[model samples]
Target: MLDIAEELNAWAAEGRDFAVATVVAVSGSAPRRPGAALAVDAVGTAVGSVSGGCVESAVYELCRQALADGRPVLERFDDDEDDDDEDGLGTGLTCGGAIDVLVLPVHAAGPVRPVLAAALAATASGGAVALARIVTGPPALLGGALLVHGDGTRHGGFGGHPELDDTVAAEAAAFLDAGRTGTVEVGGRGARCGSPVTVLIESAVPAPRMIVFGAVDFAAALVRVGKFLGFHVTVCDARPVFTTRARFPEADEVVVDWPHRYLERTATDARTVLCVLTHDPKFDVPLLRLALRLPVAYVGAMGSRRTHLDRLERLREAGVTERRLAGLRSPIGLDLGARTPEETALSIAAEIVAARRGGTGVPLTGAHTPIHHDGPLGVGSPA
Candidate 1:
């Protein structure tokens, strides 16, 4: 699957056959979402995970079986009370959820290997691509796949009907545009007359951006955290001497331009996060004036209470609206009583994640709220 594309791409480059088990659907409280996968090579080596360890062994065996038989298999694992085999050998999820996995082999002579390999390569290189596979359909088309690139070009087909291939490609392109990985239900043969087919479209897009507008020590630590959270982090500052690649090696880019000037020219989207660690009013005021108006996911500034109040007055004088100012997270990061740079960076990253994931930034120890939230406040929510 595209989730483990880097490793699987290497396997394909080496001409090693492997079986990939991808989660096509889930019901209830499943750990992994659609497109999560686990792959096993012909030599018994495994990489990646489909269920975070709950149903890994069973899925591993399924991958091995798929590799041996050269046939695709769809298996469902669910929590069943009737089963008494409690040695942990049962494939049920301990979280009481259900997941449907589709296992397909990628042998050297397989018809779909080239398509899969091309998808893997594109995904590993951070290019936009989508892999659409038939999760539920006729036996002949069960594991058929199509690779849709960002430019709307495609490779491979279901081989069932041209209409079906066309329909899936369009649907996959839509998913790719949205950077989503999930399933779409369509009638067999691309019309509503026959049995329904569920196509799992796995989309891979470049990571979202996290622009840290200060080359301070805290920014260094924050860059590491941002990378760990799968962000394309950039560190920007006006001072050339302070903003160097050596100071922030983990950052994807180190830009030596005035914060506001650089941000004006660079690109940002709803998923982009802006962190203004340059507490100086000269830098913070101009940069934040532009940042607060942009349609970005988060905009936080690092400063003390007094500094924040003064900065707010300066922004007010700079013609920023109250509505726009409300979006700023001055004194950035949750109140963690953090003193060290690393701890402060952790707190800042925590607040960013909380905003993106719809968390309350409160202790979960005594809270009765749902551990996972899937509402409008999720990633890419209105900023």
Candidate 2:
């Protein structure tokens, strides 16, 4: 969706008329999840994809028709023919995958321009907003969604369902706060035609934060790698001399505050990543203390074997429990025998990716430990 929104912004900036096609529901095999999008410019150039290639061309044609006819439409596709797995949708999927898609004519939400503008603004700043589009079975959620947390208060929404408005708004707020994309159950029970409705909660989070708490050369390399990976890199150190903007031009911010104090200020899981390259007890001891307390997605420490052991002892003495200490990825990065600082950054980034994805590729259901060690273990997810 972010990609589509970006392309839309570019198109609108350059004065191109376009429509956005989205996969609103699925009954069986699905190539992409719900809320997947594909932007269709008037002349048939498309960006992003809702289905592999199974339905993109078809969806684009429908978008053109909607643009001409001036009314949103629902379409379906069934590639149940003899198309090999590699030929078309990339699934080589000749077997069978049916899908339900909606082609919405994206004429700015009215005052459509400002409404669309507000949604884009939230996305630009990495804020959260829900787009409640009514596609299947009625004129209920036709207008748009009440985009919360942006330039304006209430944006667009389903016409005339005050109860639904309240319920969906509450769910939308919860999804935005968590920085997640999900579908909530609501609307369709009351007198409004009773169609089981699905509202997609799309989060417009700023680029992820990558905070390196040391000003070493490793920190510089990590900042470069983090930027390549789309993180809003920040290199921080208490030493003004070591931490300079020249070292990391890619970094969104650089602070001369103490490592521990900075963690206290901004250390939530969604917006923060603490990379302790300082490797100094004076630096890492306090930094690690504050990092473990928060629900950060990744907290990695770069150090030698001896340094790792010593740091663990300090954390233990600081009254950090074994369970919490277990989460501390000392000697961070995968066991890829990374020798150089660059290789080490790749290895660490790989582990961080796996952690965020919540798996080590090891089968949790087959193993004896807890599913996540935290979240739900992906039941039949590919290895």
Compare the candidates by lDDT and give the number of the best one. 1
Q: Name model 1 segments beyond 4 Å from true.
A: 81-88, 375-383
Candidate 2 ranges beyond 4 A from true positions: 13-16, 25-32, 51-55, 75-100, 108-114, 139-143, 150-152, 189-193, 361-383
Q: What does candidate 2's lDDT look like per residue over 66-136, in tens digits?
A: 76775767766655643563555432223265666767666533334455555756665456565555554
lDDT digits (tens) for residues 208-248 of candidate 1: 89999989999999999999988899999999999999999
**lDDT at 95, model 2:** 26
RMSD, each candidate, Å? 2.4, 5.1
lDDT (0-100) at residue 337 of candidate 2? 75
Query: lDDT scores for all predictions?
Result: 0.89, 0.68
C-alpha displacement of 119 in model 1, angstroms?
Answer: 0.7
What TM-score, to 2 decimals, does candidate 1 have?
Answer: 0.94
Best by TM-score: 1
